[model samples]
Target: MMAFFEKLERKFGRYAIRNLMMYLTALYAVGFVISLVNIQIYYEYMSLDVAKILSGQVWRLITWIMYVPEQNVLFAAIMLVLYYSLGTNLERVWGSFRFNVYMFMGYIFLIIGAFILYAVYGEAASVFLLTPDSLNMSIFLAFALTYPDMTFYLYFVLPIKAKYLAFVYLLIEVYSFIIGGVITKVSIGLSLLNFVIFYLMTRNWNRISPKNVVRQVKFKKAVKMRPAGEPIHRCAVCGRTEKDDDTLEFRYCSKCKGNLEYCSDHLYTHTHVE
Candidate 1:
């Protein structure tokens, strides 16, 4: 899937929107204002009603995303700012093209999932209005997966890691899917399915390949055969091992494609292994 995305990038990269988050944030601002003034207008015209869609109100398919997820202005403001940052950072790391693909795929999934519900429940599905709530969650989940160690403030107070927060969210979503109605199950499943595919595509599958298996055997043998006093952890650059200084800390670079460790002194200074 990653390779397929790369192929698409090569072909359509020119059309990718730069500063895409800026546009999304602008729409969020519009939504926030609407929520402040008249939210009922959104439910009547903009909300995603599968029944209306099937009845030829197809514009609802896209306009529904324009409604702010939170009704409170303060909460809505926070959501807008939080997602804008997440979107921009993701675009920076993944490139404009891949970021666009990730976001648009999420939207596509929601649209398809809504239709699936309509098919299963018929006219009853109209009450299950899909919002951009799950889509925003996807953005946050993607950010967490890409930069798991990144820290966020909880209500501008306590500090928490992105991975931990995503875990809590996943648990909640799973519970909701298990206990809630058919619409909730379908919605949560589709959103989570998007994240699962993104996660799989981002992973280094070669680690489980036959060549890596052979290399692992060789690496283990080398580890055992080395001098007893030799340190197991060493920086890829500068060749300094833990044996050199007890205070020197080492960690694997997350941005690097493979397991490349670096000592604290060189961790941020050295070029990435790619």
Candidate 2:
């Protein structure tokens, strides 16, 4: 899966959008303004209605993303800011191309799920699949997975880890799916499929295992127990020993006159010794 993404990056990375989340947040803000003026207009034109979409109102396919989660104006503002932060961080961690793919795949899944629901129940599917709540939830889930230890203030009072919040959200979604109508159940499942597939593809089992933790501890102990002595190598130009900076890499200057050792920083820039 990583190989496939690498191939995609090589071929199409140049076209990937930078700060894609900022644009999405802008759309939500626009939707909010429209809603304040006349929510009926937004529902009639912007919301994802399969019947309308099938009957030549095809714009809903893309415009449906503007369906911001229902909340008060103050809360909505805070949530959008949080979402923008999450999106930018994910893009940085996963790279622009991969982040684009993750978001686009979620949109594609929602579209397919909408059509599938439409097939199952002719027009009623439109009523239940109105909002992009599932997509928003998936984004939160992704952020939690990526930065499990990050803390956030819940209601500007209590501090809670993002992973714990995500877990609570997951439980709520599970309950909703069990009790919700067919369209609701299907929407939840399809929206989460992107995160599920992504997690499976990118997770490293070894990093999370007990054996790896033990091995790391033993390695650290061995390093600490080593005899104290002068570093075997030192930079000729900088005169900084490896003991001072473990990250410093020493290399013999190939172009220099004798065997002159130079640190990585000065390896190419230093003049040749006579």
Candidate 3:
């Protein structure tokens, strides 16, 4: 796994467009500021209309991530903080490039699914066409799902896992599916699909092949290294240098030794009783 990741890091590098999660957070903040001045501007620019994404307005798929309704200032702020914290951690772990790829891939998949839905039901069938609320919430739901175990203080008092919170949010969306608006239902479905696609594509299971291959190569290289002329110091037990030198072939036993073979350091370290 380490080798595979190292190879990938070498190919992709630490700094790339993907590692710009911080930039995304900043852009989202700026979008909120501008949209607060005029909410309809967000709708016109950021929200991905079925027609727009399909008509090669590719930015629509990604720009929607920055779209937060002007009226929901507090809600958007809370969501952005959570996303920034988790996204930064994820970027550090995966490095910037991989995390960016992970997120953008999710966005791409969601857009593709939306396109398919449009093909089946026609452009107006999209809930996003009717309202942008569903689109905004999908981005939030995707981040929450990615780092579900992340804990946050509920009401600044109770600690709760984001996953549990996500579950509740999902349930709410389910209720919305039954009684909530059409756009709400579409958002819920797309958000869930986003999580599934990301989970599958970046999964550890798919990594096993590259990981094992790199390990095998490393093991082979290690086995091939010869144990060559390693320098040895005195072996105190017998008072002889284990290291071979060119000029001397000193033997240590009483029968062969003319001069006492003990190095000065070994003389005090051990006793040879006659």
Using lDDT as the measure, the top candidate is 1
How do the residues 220-272 of candidate 1 rate in per-residue lDDT, one tens digit apiece?
78889899888978999888997897656676655465667777556534676
After superposition on all C-alphas, the RMSD of every candidate to the true structure, in Å, is 5.8, 9.4, 18.5
lDDT of 2 by residue, 1-274 (tens): 5456556777998898889998999999988878777878877898778889989999998888887656479978988988999998788766777688788888888888888778888877767664677877799899887667778899889999889999999999999989998767877887788889977765544444676566557646765876689465678877997788775556554335554667655653466687
Lowest-sum lDDT 10-residue window in model 1:
247-256
Q: List residue ranges in candidate 3 displaced over 4 A.
A: 1-18, 52-62, 70-72, 121-127, 130-150, 178-182, 205-274
TM values, all candidates: 0.76, 0.75, 0.56
TM-score of 3: 0.56
Q: Score residue 96 of candidate 1 by CA lDDT.
A: 83
Order of quality (TM-score) = 1, 2, 3
Please identify which of the two predictions, 1 or 3, would achieve the higher lDDT against the true structure: 1
Report, for every candidate in turn, its global Cα lDDT versus the true structure: 0.79, 0.77, 0.59
Residue pairs clashing, model 1: none
